[model samples]
Target: MGPTVTLLISIGLCLDWAVRAQQDPLPRPTLWAIPSPVVSKGADVILRCQGHLGSHRFQLWKDGELRDERNTSWQQAEFMLRNVDDWRYAVNYSCRSGQGPLWSELSEPLALVVTGAFPKPHISSSHYYSAITPGTTVTIWCYISPQGPSHHYSFALLEAKSLEPLQRQSPTGTPAAFSFPSVRAEDTGSYSCVYYRKTAPHMASWPSQTLELTVSGFLPRPTLWAQPGLVMTPGANITFWCSRPKMSSLGEVIFTLWKAGTQEPLQQQISAHLWTSFLLPPVRPENTGSYSCTYMVQTASARGSEHSEALELVVPGSLPKPSLSALPGLVVEPGMHVILQCRQPPKTFLNSLTFTLLKVGTPQPLQSQSPAGTSADFPLLSMRAQDAGNYSCVYHERMAPHQVSDASEVLEIWVTDALPKPSLIAWPGPDVASGANMTLLCQGPSWSTRFILHKEGSMDTPQDVSQFSLTHVTPKDSGNYSCRYQPGTNGSLWTQPSDPLKITVRASVPSNTLLITLSCVSFLLVCLLLLAIFCHRSICIAGALHRDNLKRFFCCPCLPQGVCLPHHAEAPRDEALYTEVAKERPSEPSVSNSKDPEGVTYAHLNLRTLNKRQADPKETPIEPTVYATVSLD
Candidate 1:
């Protein structure tokens, strides 16, 4: 009963435990879950088999007929109907699982409901109304039959033909609704919706009813028609018609005729489609422009269509009055130019124009057939007296078979010739000799002419001499004179005169001859004064020499009396003394001594007498000393 008994008991216990575990694996299937009641047709339906271990294989049946069987990898085996058909409506379906001896009882039957197809959505005619004019709201309804408590329905509005969804909403029951607050013409089209059951997986019902919607509102813009084309001449009557297809059947139409860009209608409130006629009776140049029309229905809302296309009115025949003016006024001088401008009123269609210049008081123009439009210039080349005249112009249009415009106002012109020669005449006749008073008269045929006079054989040029006169004339004043005449502008030419007239004037003595003689004497006196001034200058030079000698005499120092002596004959000693004396005495006179020294004096009466005595030895000897002096101190 030791190790052998213990090993046998352990093996038996392990085998028994294994047997019990196999007997108690998972519980076998007793029931299967069924799909919900009231499922929409054309939607998938599923059945589920649930049980314990060893229930891998299961079989599903519809009304006791085996529809499908499958071995399960899942805890519960599944049965599926791809899109339930009408034959599956309210049908009994069940499921069973497990092998021969261990097979489970059949599950309770499930009542499968296949709902009717979803009804197409519908919208009433009244559901399509406008927000403006015939202001109204639009309503649409989505309906599905045989409703279920667990079923949910949704409504949507889709664009016509495109099927593009516009809006969506959930409904509490089978029928759903959608509304538009303001309906418009654009809201007209097909609309649809769909429903589904919550109990069934992958079950969406078919589309509900589809409805066509038409929104009523104002008509689109009315088209316009006229009796003739837009451009018409004067006196042509035009009729305009306005109509719209939508509003054609409605009652009491009101039409209005209007010119483009103007709010006030030319005609209004006419009852017919061919509403009114615009009569351009005898239309003038001013009546041309663009025209249009509008149509309205006489309802409480008074809805109106947009205006029609424009029609242009034109006038062809009439031309406005033309006016002409010269740029610089009339009466132009020779060789000058003038501009003649022609013009018509504004907004007038002037295709062509012309201008002309005429002589005064003459119908025939001096210049004509000039180019057209507003202005032209009149050139008076080297104008003659005959070129002076009155000028006017005419204007016209260039349309085929040309039409002429009214004549312009007339303008006057005057032209004159160059200046003329003047005449010179001596008054008291040309026979008057020298020493006569005279006057010169310059005259021309017309007093309007200006006179100029010139003298012959003289350097002076001609000068303006309206009048000429002389108080007195001398022989030097004799000369021939000529004159030229310039006429003032009276549309006349200037003139030239004949050769100069000769006049003679002789010299006469004047009363101021004494004064002349006096002037001559005064001039001679002035000459003599100049000569005396020259001679006085020579005498002054001689006096200057004598004065110089006197100054030299006064300036000499006095000789001492003892040192000077006169020359004398004596013995040798005496002679020696005489030499001494001679040495002391000066040859020139002593300036200080008035008398000769005592016992040593010499005398002289005149230099000439002394010179004579010296020249002649026989002359008697004079006293040796004229006077003598004795020195005391």
Candidate 2:
């Protein structure tokens, strides 16, 4: 028996003693229970073991390493876990009596399943059930089991259904939280997260409860935009567009447009992701109204956003033409009261009325209003020239006060001063002579009927005279003449004096001188006429005398004795008378008669006559000489 055999014998005896000691039931083995096998990391878990008797102490071990030991007066033993990890799972633990070489039998293996690391970071929003404004920030938190220890955690966010990667966050301490800044509409969707061991990125755990993180506060604000501003002309193209605010993601937005106060929306379902616009190609006149729009999110938890302010629309049309009128049309003179009336087409309200009185060339305004109703007046003073001018009035409806009325036809007024003094105007100018048929005319241009002509410096008052005239104007008629005109009984001032008219009268021609000249010319004419008549009578008288002598001498011889002698028979008486004449003759006649030879018979007869003359002077004895002379006869 060497040292080796002695060692082997000693080891066998010790083993037998260990087996007999295990069979002895003086102190029973303690059993430890790991309560709540599944637990999140960084969380506290309890390992509890109880004994049938109260006189026992408990100790906890993991992989045969001492974790905790305690002496208790009660039958229960408990061990608190500060932090849990993957190494702490499937641990063998037991309980033992206090300070003794005796230990309890090893209890059954207790398994722990850590369910939390960055526990599926849940994303919550202020408005979780409704849409939110774009460009707003939201916060999400990572939580684990309530009993877990505080530890650092790393988190990530992903699309819920598609599992598309969205955002990742840095590691944070226990109860980790993350913030999304300036979120957009595209961020609106179903979202989820997971937790992983800090040192091992590939060895990640499943999400807790599949927390449905519906990200909000990322919806676009609905916009209202239209074509025209105030007036939308008929037949014009008008378009309305409903869109999200600019610089926002289109995938997260849904647009719907509606007219204000209308039950039916103008655009029913507008998916901004498809078109991003709601267009009304041709806007009609009837579509004029107030309009607005709303926005929605495209996530599983759909929600509606706020509406936009209303925008007004208007249409265009032509305005109607205006009309005008006046009150009294008869003689409108200064100093006489009259109204100027204006009018227009019948309308709802009297908005604008304007009245104006314009002189032909004046630039000043008389009167003006917005919509004119009836009339205006011009009071009468003593009518003057300046008051005479054209007058008119006009008006229109209230809504469009700027619309003007058609100008009325212009009217003219006649005004006059009191009766003017009568003044005379001569046709052939000034001076008139006497015995000349002169016309004296009395003329007054502005005289009011009653005109009187008077002599200047005369004692008599003015006579009711229309005109003054003289048949033969004399010097007496020459004087200063003045005329005045008055309207009524009261005599007014006299007119300016007429220039003095001088008339001169001349003497008449003598009657005798005029008759003498007339008689001399008449006598000469009568003498010439008488001489022509005398020549015509002389020729006839001479022819008649010659015929008578020839008939007496020749016809006497052929006649019978008694008839022929009878013609000379009265010669006896003639012879007696011849004897008497011969007796009276002188003897001196014989001497004178003897001078001519042919007169010898006359001498003898003369002597005889002388002798008988002497004798007969005394008696009738001279009959013998007369008988001889009678025989010769």
Top lDDT prediction, candidate number: 1
Best by TM-score: 2
For model 2, residues 203-224, the per-residue Cα lDDT tens digits are 2344534333333543445666
Per-prediction TM-score, please?
0.21, 0.25
lDDT (Cα atoms) of all candidates against the true structure: 0.52, 0.48
Per-residue CA lDDT of model 1 for 228-344, tens digit only, reads: 643344576656665544322345667777765456887766564434344434543344445677777676757666677665443333455456666465545777766666556
In model 1, how large is the Cα lDDT of residue 55?
A: 64
